[model samples]
Target: MKTAEYEIVRDFAAQREQVYAAWTRPERFARWFGPRMFTTPADRVVLDVRPGGAWQATLVGEEGFEVTLRGVYREIAGPGRLVFTTGDPDSPGDGPASVATLTLEECEGGTTMRFHQFGVNTDAEHAEQARAGWLEFFDRLAEHLAVQATSSKVSARP
Candidate 1:
């Protein structure tokens, strides 16, 4: 049976490199990479941004539920594209692992990030929940990027 798939596109008022770094770098990733009700501590995230490199993170939810996510990078095309496979460590993989592709385009205002994931959970409800979670995560990411940009400007001032 084919699994559910989901896609989300978000535009940020930040450069492609800044957005890409926020996704690929461990410290930056942990800042905005989990569900809104969860916290992904920086020290609990391990990332390697190269082909075949592995990544793992532990998310602690507000209700005290903890989730561990693991993935491997399949490709990294600098500030434009990234492909990876991600899954919960405790879940049994009945079929193929979920593969995600992120494409970043530099636009006049900032960057547009297209996030697509295939072979996710088998149910539509799960996909919907995942989509909502991603939306929250992206909102947080945008805020983080905006703050970073402001800080950068402040630090650059003479």
Candidate 2:
């Protein structure tokens, strides 16, 4: 049997453009794209951030194990939405790919991000792991945005 699609909605206290940049920019993306316990080296990240472009990154765990994520952008709508196909780079052939759609909406105080990932087929254990990983990843992303917003505000002041 195939695993079900997963969707999550998160709100960030940052401008829509800022949140979008954090997701699309390689330098910023590598800082928070992995699970909470993993670290992504700056030199190991590559993000093209355009329709038909490719993005790749490697995450290193505390034990030095590496996980490579490779993806191709399917659609790009400025700072509002993005769709991509992603999978494990080390898998045989092209690996099991999933389509991810992320939509960002500007709200009263910030941005609301709706994320949906489909076409995932794995064992129950792996599906649960993936869900947990995404939750942790988003948690890290929120933290990164908070720090960026604070620093930006400080720098903007005289």
Candidate 3:
């Protein structure tokens, strides 16, 4: 048996509130959940961002390789932290639904986020790849935030 712990950090060019909004809001989520060179469009997405809510994503690429991921939101700390457990709740040993925590800290010019995932010691291989994929997605999120911030500023100009 092996254990795996993977974390991700990102500095977005937007305020904490905006960053948080992008995650909790469905429309915003559909916009940037996809990474560069990939598209996790709104059509193939389902997000319920509340305690005990479900989060699902199925990315269709190439042939019939569909990636289905499901999770439940356990704790939400406004624009600061979001905690969740992965895997489905109906099955025993269903990957244990590892606990994941995403925290946002206000920085000088923007927001810095730290993503911590635990309870992965039960399954190391899959968790490792998931972490890598998450990092890539975060990069795309950064790009989306940058553009969104610019748009917001432009719209606010009087």
Candidate 4:
């Protein structure tokens, strides 16, 4: 079967550790895990953040539909890189599993994130849609990080 893939690169005005935590920490991940029209409750997100550990998140859409994504950690290099496989939890081996890789590098001002997902069991059109969805999710992440940065600064003021 022909597989689809997508790559996205983003730069955030936050430290690499902070950006990595946004992906590894469940509380922070839930805040920005889904598309703009969907919300992932913190209770619905689980991130073990260890190789062989499992992670999952269910996003509830505005129209009342739910989408759940579950995967297992394949590799984790804290504050640097992460690799995981995404597939249906209930039904394994039904199709090719998608692998997602995220690499974070310290840049002059902040962190540069490179994200790539491949091995999707779908066509190009659907893959493009998935890319768009991720773009929306990243937009939310940018906002989340900005808010956290502001709050941290406010609390640090003496």
lDDT of 4 by residue, 1-158 (tens): 55898899999999999999999998999999988778899999999889999999999986789989989999999889999988942344556467889999999988999999986466787678888988999999999999989998999999
TM-score of each: 0.90, 0.89, 0.84, 0.92
- Rank ordering of all candidates by lDDT, starting from the highest: 4, 1, 2, 3
Clashes of 4: 0
lDDT of each residue in 1-158, candidate 3, tens digit only: 34567788888879999889877876677667654555566766777878888887666656666666668899888799898777743442535457778999999999999998875435777777778778887877888898898898899999
| Pairs with backbone N, CA or C atoms under 3 Å apart (clashes), candidate 4 | none
Better of 1 and 4 by lDDT: 4
Please state every model's RMSD to the true fold in angstroms: 2.6, 2.7, 2.5, 2.2
Residue pairs that clash (backbone atoms under 3 angstroms), model 2: none
Per residue, candidate 2 scores C-alpha lDDT tens digits across 25-101 of 88899899998778898799988888889889999997789999988888999799999877732342534557889
Estimate the overall C-alpha local distance difference test score of candidate 4: 0.88
TM-score of the candidate numbered 3? Answer: 0.84
Q: Which stretches of candidate 2 lie over 4 Å from their true place?
A: 1-3, 88-95
Summing lDDT over every window of 10 consecutive residues in candidate 2, give the lowest-scoring window: 88-97
Task: Give the worst 10-residue stretch by lDDT in candidate 4.
Answer: 88-97
